[model samples]
Target: MKNKIPNKIHIIGSVGSGKTTLARELSSMLNVPFYELDNVVWKRHEGHEDIRRTEKEREEYLNTLISSNTWIVEGVHNEEWVSNSFLNAELIIFLDINYSVRTYRIIRRFLLQKLRLEKSNYNPTLKIFFKMFKWNRYFEEVGKPNFFKKFGDYDDKLLVVTNKKELENYFT
Candidate 1:
């Protein structure tokens, strides 16, 4: 097995796949800083897709975080930023829960957010939920295999966790 005491970890998954939740958990378990990619990519805005900032700014932010010797970065934009962010990661956990469970969680998360009027930098809407699900499907059908192949070429440290129980055991 690769080093369990990873200085850096990247969690990549489709929407509602529990990437952020798992990231938070791992960060606490590992005593490392954690960052949510969506918060970095999108500023707070209403009725807007929120313009993406320049790549340089993003890189700068990531550099600052990764320089800390330990961090858990989670997001769906693996295709765009995984290599740069995860190249040095001692572990990469890809959450691959069932579609039904993910959909349920997405809906529940949306309702909770709306009811609580949560002050999220990026709000979750029904449209975004469906789009995310579609993206998740695409990833399952195409993204995961391709990512594994590509990531394998770079590093041998990877763990594909399908459920929370499995993840807990692996981490333990």
Candidate 2:
């Protein structure tokens, strides 16, 4: 059977897993709008400090996005607040990239952001840079296994991808 592209896709992974990049590509290929889960959690204003959204507001915002006809949501968050996205998605892509690759990406991304070669929602400071490593490791140990345990019920439609090439087959 020919693979059919999904209208509502949920992409999840640790930091530097290329969730944003893949989401953007898929959004273009699928002709759908994409949103970052981080955006839902924080209110961003260019050249100003970002404000964290209230829990209720974040839920409401996320709900609005999921309620749309078509969307691609990518994020590193794996919590009760985001469980609805998993339930609502037509396809769930868990990016299980190599730890070493993620580590390299984390460093590269921070450098790009610092050099202003790339734009960031938040200021790239030394503190956040350190936290990215911590978060990446946490996701590997606690977050990775927790995802399977919690969201494994959706395995029928879930696609665990370790490499970006794997996605090309599905999209093409």
Candidate 3:
């Protein structure tokens, strides 16, 4: 089936679910700027310290992006703090790939980042790698369900993709 995606899109998914990759592709294809929630949430001012932005700051920043006519916002964040983006988005894409596939991607991405074969927003270390796996598990068990429940009201605008092929088909 052919789908007409909107310019204002919000992509939500668990870690390693290809949210970033999809966001980048969509941004290029649609010629719209994309923002990663992680960057807006965490600020590494100096070294490895993750200084989180205040709720007001994040809201202001997000408001600025949303004020634009077209944009793509992607991240794993599903908290109330980010509800504005969801509300403002014309479409919400959820990458609901299988746990096994996500796990494999996580490991592969970690290795690539560690080897400097891939660029990452944060430092690639054993600690962060292990944390990713843990986060993945938590997401699969808890976050995914919570997202469904919380965003159920937006089902009409939500597009759930369970595999790469399905996502490619939708985009095509």
Per-residue CA lDDT of model 3 for 1-172, tens digit only, reads: 6788688999999999999999999999989999999988877665657788998888788888888889999999898878889998999999998888989999999889888999988888889889988999998888889988998799888889897787778778
List the candidates' TM-scores in order.
0.83, 0.97, 0.93
Estimate every model's Cα lDDT from 0 to 1: 0.76, 0.94, 0.89
Worst 10 residues of 1 by lDDT: 117-126
Best-matching candidate per TM-score: 2
lDDT of 1 by residue, 12-40 (tens): 88778999888877778778889988766
Selected candidate, larger TM-score, 2 vs 3: 2
Task: Pick out the ten consecutive residues of candidate 3 with the lowest summed lDDT.
Answer: 42-51
- Report the backbone clash tally of model 3: 0
Q: Residue by residue across 1-172, what tens digits does model 2's lDDT show?
A: 5577899999999999999999998898889999999999999988888899998899889999999999999999889899999999999999999999999999999999999999888999999999999999999999999999999999999999999788877777
Best by lDDT: 2
Ranking by lDDT: 2, 3, 1
